[model samples]
Each structure stands twice: as structure tokens, then as C-alpha cells.
Target: MLTINNLSVHYGGIHALKGINLEVPQNKIVTLIGANGAGKSSTLKSIMGLAKASGGSIKFNGEDIVNKPTTNMVSKGLVLVPEGRRVFSNLTVEENLFLGAYLRKNKEEITKDLNWVYELFPRLKERVWQKAGTLSGGEQQMLAVGRALMSKPKLLMMDEPSLGLAPLIVKDIFGIIKEIHRNGMTILLIEQNAKAALEVADYGYVLETGSITLEGPGKELMVNDEVQKAYLGEHK
Candidate 1:
């Protein structure tokens, strides 16, 4: 469970996010969808402490984590699979996955999680010894998500997981997302593909110019007139 209230972020004089309020309940997928420069990624970065928040509160469970260090956030079971699938290019798939569990000392549990991740991503299992950079874009994205899962996150925050992949691969990725949620992982997803994101999300929010403009059930928002016209590319 996560809560963000009155969240604001600024870069020099440029206001990036303004008083954004949102929540991710336990075992649910909450999506934030918007066009470029809408501050969707900034919200996730602020929660992970990657972006400095000028003011506001980011609370995971019950504690305030507005300005907490990124490492601290990871330890608290909050993890981010950033946009662009920033994988360690030179590292082998196995090595990349092991790095995700860097904070944990329990070898047995880490091994178990490694197996689980492999199961979740069979392609990574096949390419266990291959360099991450050599993998296809879809494989690299899978590696990114698999690496994040290795950390055993409580609330997984993913930014644009479907970016740049083929349509079929995007569909596969979203399917995996739904499976992840079905397995009881709470997700805060920021996606540019509104149709795909809303289809998998339980609740969805529309962010515009650094603020929340619409919030509703994912299905409801999917059929909304404005959402249809703007994000879904449908005209009434």
C-alpha cells in the first residue's frame, strides 16, 4: 500500500509536479497515464527519491518517505523499473539478476527469488549466460522486470514498460504485468500506452501538466470521453 499526498517537485524555476495526490492499495495495479511532460515519470521518481521533491509526502504503508534515499526506499520494499529498461549492458543475464538482490543477505531466499524470476521470464532463463546488451529489446525489458522482481519488491513501480516494443511484445509484457498483479504484487505503473495500461489496471489516473486531472476505475476511465479522445485515439 502506498500514498502520495500534496506531492510537488521543481527543477530550478520549472515546476514539474504540483500537489499530486494518488494511492496504490494492496494487491492492486494503479496506473498513471499521460502524454510527454505530464510528470508521470516524475511522480514515480519522487516516490523512489530519485527526483527531489520540493514539498509533499510520499508514504509507503504508513511512514513518510518523501526525501528518503533510494537505497532506503529499496530496502523498504519499494522498487522502480525505470523507463528504457536500464539494464547493465555488459553483465550476463544471471549476473544482472543477482545484482537486484544486492541488499539481501539471506542466500537461500535470494536463490528462491532467482528461481522465481527465471520462471517468470523463461527467455531470460534460456539466455542466462548471455550479455544483457546482446538480448533483443523485448528480452532486455523482461530482464529489467525480472531484475526488479529479484529484489522482492512490495510495491513495484514501473515507468513506461511498454515503450518501443513491437505490438505483440507489448501485449506479452502487459500480460506479464497482469500475472504479476494476480500473484499479489502491488504496482504503480506509468504508461504511455493508455489502452494497454488501463486494461490491466484496477484504477487509473490521468495526469496533465504535473497534476492529476482524472481518477476513476480503470474500465470507467477507458470509456471516458476525454480519455478516449486524448489517450486512446478514439473520437466521438
Candidate 2:
């Protein structure tokens, strides 16, 4: 449902992204797997208008959204759960979630979405009145995803959801990701954990030094020699 073509981004003469092209089809999870400085996050940021695109087009369901404001993008059903779970530290869990629906006017629908988030994340419900900063890392990440879901996204873009967590927690997070996708949310995932990312995605792309190096079905890329050598820690 989202298409990025010839996308480029520059940070004061430093070329961060170079004419990269990718797509996320409806109801599918598309992942971008890469190492640090590979422009994976920049691609998501540019799509959300957090990073200025120097050239090319970002289209959402056929219309060009390259020049749209971040708020406009969110209102348009394109939402990003950024690399770090940037939750409102001082706000209560409920308050933080409510902020996601700041642009909406329908009280009943907002309440319905809130309950849906709570059902998907029972921990957030238990800590509804607790300050977001007090939650554990896993809880905070759940809160981040829950908050994003409150916005009722058509396409959800998540950057590094598994970062800095215990292995068990990572598994839980990826499980939730799969659950989200199964429930019909289109996802564009950026992850350094290539193996886990590919396992959950329907399609995958490998980005290196600001350009796409490979693209294929997720399972195909998972078993690829180059992918195995570089990202999956396998040696022939």
C-alpha cells in the first residue's frame, strides 16, 4: 500500500540514502534488514517526513506524500513506532495512549481502539495509571506499540522493536508483531536482527550503505548465502 521510488536523503553533504526503491503491499509485512549506518531508519524517517527527502517520491495508496507533514502522514493512516520507544515519560500509560488519537474527534471509536490496545497488551491495562517511565523495557515497548495502534494505522512502520531486550522478551515482541500483521496491519519493519525479521516478514530487502542490495520473499532471503554470511552469522 506504500511505495517509495528513487528515494534519496542527504544530511548536509553526507549522503544518507541514495535513490532507494521499495514497496509494502497491502496486508503484508515488508522488512528492511541492515547493519548500523545502512540507512534503514532514514528510509522510514523520510517516509514519515521526519527526515527531509532530497529527491524522489513517497506514495501512500497512489498519492505522493513526500511533502506531507508528519501530522498529516499520521492522520493519513501512516504511523511510525520509532527506533527507540519514545513514550511520554511523565504521562500515565492511559494518557500516553490517548495522545495517539489527538487528531480524532470520535469519542466512541477512540474508546473502542483504546480497549483493543488494552486487550492486545494486558500489561498496559494493568499499568493504566502508572507513569510510562516507570514501566520496564518490555512494558514500555508494548506501550509504544499500543499507542501506535490507538491511531488506527493502515500501514505501521516500526524501527528496531527488538533492540536492547532480553531474548525471551524479543521473542514476545516479535510474536506481537506477527499478531499485528495477522490482524491486517501492513508493516514496514526495520531491524538489525535479520533472522527474526525475515522469519516474520512476507517480503524482505537488504539495504547497504543507503541502497537496496537484495530483495526477495522473506524465506528466500533468509536462506541466501550473502544474507546468511553477513546478517545471519552463518559461514559456509
Candidate 3:
């Protein structure tokens, strides 16, 4: 569904990403995991065109999207629910959701997506009239994901969907992610929660200091000696 080749990014003198070559197959959940400064988020931002890439290419659905404007990417069905749950503070939950479908021309299609969002997160449904600022962190996270889904993206790129949520809430969110994948939407997930992310991912990449150091099947990554020691926290 997505392919990135020799992707590199720089911020002033800092190399945020170094020649990242990666591929995400159709209709599957692919995750990139690493420590705090491992360029995981930078890769996602590059895909969204939020961050300018110094070099390389990003392709989606067989078309080259490298250097495409973020708005153009949205129009082309690539949406990013960024790291933080950045919902509109003053807007009602329903209003926030409505804005997500702004790119959709059909009212009926927008309404259908709204209904699906509510079904996916009943709490959002219950608080439809409430202001998004009033939602708890976990609830807001769901709202963020719901808002992204409102864009009706074919490939949803989620960055740290479980950043600061409670364990139970993380489980709920991951379950929703799995459900979304089951329903045929592809996902490119960048997460720090390696354990949970790998559990649901079909494939995984281990990124360190702006480069991919390991790549394998998700289950294999879970048990790799170096991966287990550096990422999984295994003593052996």
C-alpha cells in the first residue's frame, strides 16, 4: 500500500531520518518501534508531507507522493492522526467529527462515516454534544482516531496512539485498531509500546537513531536476541 525509498530528512544540521527504505503491504498493520529519538515520528510526518524530506521518495498506491503537500495527501486518502490527541478544544465532539469529513462531497457518505465512528467508540457517541476539551485523555485519543477515520482514509498512519493512556484504555484502543484493519483499511503504526504494537502488527521494523537496524515478521521481532535485549527488555 505504501513504499518509502532512501528517505532522508534533516532539521538544520540534525539528520532526523537517514535513508529509510521501507514498505507497508496492502491491508495490513505495519509498525515502526524505537526509542524517543529514533526518527519514528519523522518518518510518518514525511509521509504526510508535514515535514519536508531532504531526499528520497514516498509512494502510496503506486503513485509517487514524495514532496506532495499535506492537503494533497489528504485528498488522496492518506491521513495522519498525530502523536498527541489534538482535538479542537472549544468544538463539540460532533462538530469536531463533522470537520473531519470536510473533504467528502457527499452528505450521505459523511453521515455514514459519522455513524461508524460513533459505533466504534460509543463514548464519543454519548458525548456527541459535549465539547472535545472536556474529554479525558483516553476519550480524546479515541476522538482523535475517530476524527482521522472521518477522513475515510485507505491507509491510516497513526503515531503513538497509546502515548500516555492507561493500560486498559490502551487495550481498548489497540482492539479498535485491529478492528479497523479487519474491516480492510491498511495501517502504518509508529509506536513506542513495542510489546503491544507487535502483538497486533503483521510486520515490524526496529528503528534506531534515524536508521532501520532490524526488520522481520512481528512475532520474530518479539523473539530476536538483539531486539529482545534492546527493545523487549529480555535479560538473556
Stretches off by above 4 angstroms in model 1 are: none
Looking at model 3, the pairs that clash are none
- Work out the TM-score per prediction: 0.98, 0.98, 0.98
lDDT of 2 by residue, 67-124 (tens): 6789999999999998889999999999999998888899999999999898889989
Residue 108: error of model 1 in Å?
1.2
**Between which residue pairs do clashes occur in model 2?**
none
lDDT of each: 0.94, 0.94, 0.93
Q: Per-residue lDDT for 93 in model 3?
A: 97
lDDT, model 3, position 209: 98
lDDT for model 2 comes to 0.94
Per-residue lDDT, model 1, residue 221, is 98
